[model samples]
Target chain A: MADPRAEILRQAAQLFAQKGYVESSLNELAAAMNYSKGAIYNYFSSKQEIYDAIIIFTLTGLYETAAKAVSEADPPVERLRQFMMAHARFLADNYDCFVTMLVGFSGMANSGLKDDALALRDAHEGLLRRILQAGVADGSFREVSAAMTGRAVLSLLSWMVRWFKPGGGKSAEEVAQEYHDLLVRGLLA
Target chain B: MADPRAEILRQAAQLFAQKGYVESSLNELAAAMNYSKGAIYNYFSSKQEIYDAIIIFTLTGLYETAAKAVSEADPPVERLRQFMMAHARFLADNYDCFVTMLVGFSGMANSGLKDDALALRDAHEGLLRRILQAGVADGSFREVSAAMTGRAVLSLLSWMVRWFKPGGGKSAEEVAQEYHDLLVRGLLA
Candidate 1:
């Protein structure tokens, strides 16, 4: 069985994602998790703590997944494509985390977790930027603002959460391939 | 002088965009607008009403701007480029409105304006789909999923609001042109 703390975080993330964080209550989360309110308090002190945990977990998970996807052994272009595919696959598998991150980041000003979330996001963006920079250096990619291009690519992948339905027409892998083709070819010199 | 109602909306949108709609109070909005709370109520019955007005105003403005940007005389590629540029310019010029729309749409489920907001969003996307379909039909663009491609394009454009700093580096036109070149050429046969 998963650790009770981990299970609590997972359930809390799902509830926060489905219902906005503001609307999701600890009682409801406890009900969904089949845990008593006292059980929840043992894992998380407050709803805000639960929300902060979700934000940190989601952002860190995304960054680590993408970072692991890229390899120096591959050509920079291939690495970039792999990074994008990893991102899409993560979003597809962790739909709740993706939604939580999106809603959390949008409301960051209201949440005390703003700086940590932004740092995680920036680090993820940095990984993409470095890949683009490498591609530019290797003459595989055209000259473009690596920062802007990285954001553009990240935006493309991140927006998948808004429309990509797991059981819907296109599988995540298929969508990733399409995006890979569109973006990789678009960046080629 | 502008209509008092329109002025109220413009000010409210700015406030809501900077501070979220949920956080922006009528008293603060009235203070920003130099109107008494009573006067604000005279114009908008409630904060929700002000938010609804902002939604209607922003979405309608975006659709109208994009509609006027496309020309029948231009080839499908040029029309697409024009459409993208027009969107970037609109976003840059109407920064507050764009931000308001983003925050509003994210919280649409809680707001009574969900259906209306979705309808406006779909209409805006329809314009892009039509452009992509026209390109595919005319052989200017390679075979692609018009609906998916449309969303992809809009995602690239819409995500600009998060990172685009007006005077920091590239102008909106420059960003738009780069995006046009990247996306339009990617779609080219």
Candidate 2:
């Protein structure tokens, strides 16, 4: 159930993630896809275009999926936990692609990508903020600074991408559960 | 008093932190220091050399300073809190430099810089890990995975570089204090 273009991005994401944009050449990417270098140009005009596309594709996809997960859940804490688990699943399934886009975006020059990147990040954090705000309004959460607390929680979740190995000791589910419990419920006995 | 050469790196660090490495040119950096481009080259071979030097100088200086702060404290929790506060001050005092080095490191392909970068990170985290382990052993802090906790705490701290505005309403001391409260005491009120 995959589009050919999606297939290309999946591969490109892995390559782009492993070797940065400058280091990842078109010929190598084409060979990985079993196509001529010209075929890549047919899909993407230039490497910069490809990089832009991959970043938007990956980040927008993540935001939308997180939004969907948030909508279908009931309790605010459950919603947050589901969001974390969904994120963990996405990273687990698309490990290299995820890492590549993150590092790429981190190191990219201030191009038009800056606006889009900020917007994407804002949109993703917006989901978490809404949940936190709702919890505060309903007296389910504390009277903390919603923006800072939301950002901190998201930061904690995103840290998984930095250290999570594909075949690490714990499954993504287990890790996500532990994080949610620790962060949301606290360590009070 | 700062050395003349150290002053150059410090100025360059501020520029690189603000404008980014690639966007910043040697001529502008030299001009800021009232030195010609040739004079800068006398100290550094290339812009990349300047960047590498600044990163090593800033992070190593920060690591040593934080280590000293922790050493001057008693009990692991107090030491850990002081370490976090010292780091926050370092980042706050040299916000641009911290942001530049962090964002700059993501894209760098140089093996020498990468090793040093990762090592510097490990050293700081290792210091935290030891404190956390000691706390757990002594029963001041509850049992937890020291490795994951260290990474989580670090991720939370490092994120300040991205969003914290230097002259914002809160001081680094205030923010670091709140962050320490959250990490050590948890959020169960």
Query: Which candidate tops DockQ?
Result: 1
Q: Which digits, one per residue and each the tens of the lDDT, describe model 1 over residues A1-189?
A: 469988888888788877777778999998887779998888789988887887788788889999999898998878887888888888887888778766566656667778988899889999989988888887777776787777778888877777778878988878878877776554212
lDDT per residue for candidate 2 within A80-118, as digits (tens), equals: 787887777776777876677655565546566768877
Best by TM-score: 1
Q: What is the lDDT of residue B188 in candidate 2?
A: 38
TM-scores, all models, native as reference: 0.88, 0.82
* Candidate 2 segments whose C-alpha is farther than 4 A from its true place: A22-28, A31-34, A71-73, A104-119, A169-173, A185-189, B18-37, B46-48, B71-76, B106-119
How many residue pairs collide in each prediction?
A: 0, 1
* Decoy 2 TM-score against native: 0.82
Candidate topping lDDT: 1
Pairs that collide, model 2: A17-A100
Candidate 2, residue A110: the lDDT equals: 53
Q: Which CAPRI tier for candidate 2?
A: acceptable
- Tens-digit lDDT string for candidate 1 (B61-107): 78889989999689878888888888888888888877887656665
